[model samples]
Target: MLTPSKPFTRRCFPAINVKKGVVMVGNATTFYDGDQKQRNVTDLVEGAKKANVVLEARQVAMKIFEDYTVSWYWIIIGLVIAMLISLIFVVLLRFLAGIMIWVMIVLLIAVMGYGIFHCYMEYARLKGTAGSDVKLTEIGFQSDVRVYLHLRQTWLAFMIILCIMEVVIILLLIFLRKRILIAIALIKEASRAVGQVMCSLVFPLFTFLLLCLCIAYWAITAVFLSTSNEAVYKVFNETVCDYAGKTCDPETFNVTNVTRLCPDATCQFAFYGGETYYHKYLIVFQVYNFFMFLWLANFAIALGQVTLAGAFASYYWAFKKPDDMPAFPIFSSLGRALRYHTGSLAFGSLILAIVQLIRVMLEYLDHKLKGADNTFARFLLCCLKCCFWCLEKFIKFLNRNAYIMIAIYGTNFCTSARNAFFLLMRNIIRVAVLDKVTDFLLFLGKLLVVGCVGILAFFFFTQRIRIIQDTAPTLNYYWVPILTVVIGSYLIAHGFFSVYGMCVDTLFLCFCEDLERNDGSLERPYYMSPELSHILWKKDAELLKSSESQS
Candidate 1:
């Protein structure tokens, strides 16, 4: 009884003590009794900020280090330094050259003055030698001597003037060196850029030009084949009949008329193969007759053949070697080929047109020459028929292998002819002797272009000597130096441009590769920050995990 009363009243050490330090079983607004939790939360946020700052600093340093490591950047810096050094060198050279040029000019003037004085003295001596027979003879000799002296003096004066001028020019070279170098550099850079651009555009341009020509050819064929252009047909018919030199009836030439003309042994022998051979012979005869009637046609065919061959040869040469491949040269060859082909085609067409006109005129003449028979008139009436046949054959040939014709036209007829010969030899030699003949032809073509270019350069240098003389009288005596400098300058410029063009071409190719790798999407970030990169990786990982878990 005493224990139950005491337990209720006394709370003695309490069976259970509820304190603020202890956490509650149920949800409560405040669980901890101290500020430790709040302090820990603040410390965590501050620590995170400090860690982020440290990471950012490290990332920045790493980026800086990486940027410095890139080869292109260092290369660019090195190139800049090199360019600066070259500029300084050029400037110094120019200064020295200028001084020399002035000195040479002064020397030239002095030499000229001396020559004039000597010539005057010679004249005075001649004047003093007149009178006695001895004196007279002496005077005559003196007169001749004076004339020679004068000529010598004049020549010497000119020579001295030229020498001095050359010296001056040599001195001025210091100044010109910079300009020359700069021009060369610009040319090189431009050439490289141009080469790359040209390479990119070449295929499309070639295709376009080919299409244009093909369309034109087709249109012409269509027009000629049309029933409307019967006039062209009439001219062809009349020319053939004139070539035959007889008013022979079509009945004799016609398929049905063979029975009447085959009475003789010669006719029987000619007709031995029957109608098929007769038809073939007639076709051949008509073609020959048309070609013969128009000499220009032969020229066109020959030119076309030659041009096609040349183009093919040039293409083969251009693609033969990896190191030899240069955009400018390829483009230049293409341009030259196009130009030559166009000119040849235009000239050929003009000539052919003229021939056709002449043929028409001749037809009129023959019409008048003949007794104006209705049979002749009938042949003339079928003029469109002959033109249609010719046009159809040509179109067929073109359609079957327009590529060959286009290639020839693009490369120029000359190149085309060379390629044709090479191909022919390749085939013939392969069949008869060896297959390596093609390699020989390829080598030959390459050698031809290279050798031709070299020879042309030499020829130009030689011819420049004359040009220099014409342009600068003072340069006559210093021909060697002047010519050397000019040629050297040109070569340097050419080489620089060529190298620059090649570099540009290579760079463009690299860019193209990059594009291809990017799959034409070009929109993804190219540059990334370390922090962003890390975040992206983390996000990616999280997404992957979530996806895997779902699966």
Candidate 2:
């Protein structure tokens, strides 16, 4: 009944009882079949479908792995090209910050405009065609997404969305013109700081390695825990009986009282389970394993953030460009973060891990309830999931800035988080506009790198190019290598650009502090770049000049 390997045709026979005359045991006879078995048609069909799906998935996975093995060298080349492009982009930002920022904005607008035009053309072309006038609601949802493309409403909706986006973007640029200038200045300043500390760009690799180790440890422990259970056998029968689910020894079951009372009953293997204390609480151990994985992964990321923040903070607070900076700032920061702030990092990581664990639990609950019909329960689960998602994001944001503060002031996690929170709140306007704009620009840079590398990979893997089509390795599915290259390129680009982002965030926080704690006097001169100071505080330019001249 449980496996398809021992399939057999079912048979039935009537049984005679001494007191009850001819007993109706045909159903009972079908239960313990030495040669045949009975099963529900629906269940059998479902089992076959599931088996087919599993087989298909395994085949696809094997093919993808084979393709990856064959195309590993090409994927490496693409990722290396992505890395070089990312590095060159960051270097060029130092000289062309404003020009690049404007160019990115223009390109975004042009892309949206083209999308609108293309949608409109498609909508026009679909007009007067058979079945094009069908309403989406009438046809309902389709498994194939391309079916929707034949409807005119889809193109109309796309055109409307693109038009709205294009208009909103143009208006935002017009309103935030001055803030964009400040963002460009910040990007320029961040570029200079990154230029000073070149080693920071490679820090993410260390974090990635640490995270991989954590994953490996967790995966191994989980596998061992899962396989630690013993086989469990139970009494099963087609007819109602007293020993329907009681534990039994398969070897000794035939002589037991259960078989004596119920002639058709049989002892069958149910699942992997045990009565031992360790096996009883294996779930708790797995939960602990997952929680530790989250904690360690977050700790690795937190360490990297603190290390980068310390390096860039040194760059910001230095009175002289490179003279006052430490000779090995990145290494010095690394040492300090490890020596003093390990506990604080652990504390922050623990908080984040707890929230993430709760989110995971909520997701598990949601999955379990998918077959349930309780509307209120589903609604509550949806709300909880949404809330925990937002909470995780907020905690991550808070922890990032808090780590920056810890790197700068050597405070505990709670104290650093509090200080960082208030610091950003005090300059909420700048936080809202300049910080996000700079982050958006960095995101665009990563996208640009990913796009360039992804296009090249797509062409090469699909053998679209004539020059190397014959040389590229053939694959079962060409998109496997293409996807690998795209994802790897994006990660490499994100790692490089994140360093620049951290530099800008550290400098911005330091700039806010410089404004509050220092005046335009020799004793408390600002440590900000001249261009940024000019853009933010035009009236103080004369005072800054006087302070500089006197010094």
Candidate 3:
């Protein structure tokens, strides 16, 4: 038998089998000339070229691996610093959220104000300089960005843009002052919740592990499924032959009548499209593998969300901070989510997975249709892709809130989704203004963490820090480690910040529910913190106070 075999993972070479007297292509080096069948001489050349390419790629991969190995400790150190910074940032939000938010707004205004000033100065300075008066529209586009920067019109345009941005930010701050206060309160409350349920910050690691497992399984299964097809052999002739396209068994191809009629004909391996029953269904198997991967990955994420939501909800619903909270809130919530709400999580994950899968299929179709000249079909595909993209985002948003509701109420997927949607709708103004504002603030927190860590990583890896110039590892590419640290830092920051985010969402929903279900009366005292209650429901609290005074 002339079947290809892999002797090792990275090293593959063709071998002649004297016992079978059959020539075979190795798996790694196989190259088809065109269509399916490979020509004898062309294939050898193509295979050698491909083999050289593979060898070069392997060498590059090895170099990267070596660089990573050498700098592994530095990477770990950078990542640990990132984690600590994230933790500190999250903890600080409890006390400094208001200060940070105000400072951010002020700084944004000042930065834009400075930008406007700088642009104006540049415009003034470049007023009479050579090429300074050139119109931007006259030049149109330039590969050299400096050319445009030399023009006064560019500075004028920049100044105008900065002015507009400055005005917009100032106007927004003026209009949304009260909402910002509410958002700050919510963020502080969320921080307090996260501080109490500290273990919630670590829960993302579990989810990350689960997702890794899902990804590994999917990749390995996909590889095996793709390679499961049996190779098909077809007749190839240097001269014209009627049976050239027909399939033949390589084992007995020599004794076949076509070979007898056409002496110059030979059998060669074509593509791996096999006709066996099992091979015929490989595409279905691959699709199933992809779907399951999506399901499991989403399930892992949903589990984390529900668990964090449950822990934070417990904190929110507790009247007296840790006194009314559970002994191990995170563990307790995890157990509850696993024991009672796995089905709900799975159900939500299933819906999300289906939507995601459909989006993937649409993307695949779009890619397949790129070469086609049908404008209508392409337009329809573009519309479908856009619609599905929006649909996926909506489902994700709905599912996130639904998981929060499920964590609080222990309800099924549909009931929780409905309740969460209606609750958000009822508080649509708050959701739009306060909640989104809080999210923006949290995003800024993440950006700050990532930026700080990324800058540190860049300096260290590039040997720009004189203090650690001798300590940093030498590398083939400094950007690799820098990028790794940046990306890792972001994930670390996102994980820690996600706890705050989930806490905010849980507390927000709890706050909304508390308003609807309770008054200031002793019988139905609100579970929300006094600060949050006073800030968000100031009018309601005032009315209640007057009513109480009248009584």
For all candidates in order, the CA lDDT equals 0.37, 0.84, 0.82
CA shift of 8, model 2, Å: 16
Candidate 2 steric clashes: 0
TM-scores of the candidates are 0.18, 0.77, 0.72
For 172-264, candidate 1 gives per-residue lDDT tens digits of 545444333322332232333333333432233333355456556545654443322111111113111322222233324444333343322
Off by over 4 Å in 1: 1-312, 318-323, 328-330, 338-345, 352-375, 380-551
lDDT of 3 by residue, 3-44 (tens): 232333365533322124334534334433224343344456
Question: Can you give the lDDT of residue 184 in candidate 2?
Answer: 86
Question: Model 1 TM-score?
Answer: 0.18
Best by lDDT: 2
Worst 10 residues of 2 by lDDT: 11-20
> What is the RMSD of candidate 3?
11.3
Which candidate wins on TM-score? Answer: 2
- State the RMSD for candidate 2: 8.0
Better of 2 and 3 by lDDT: 2
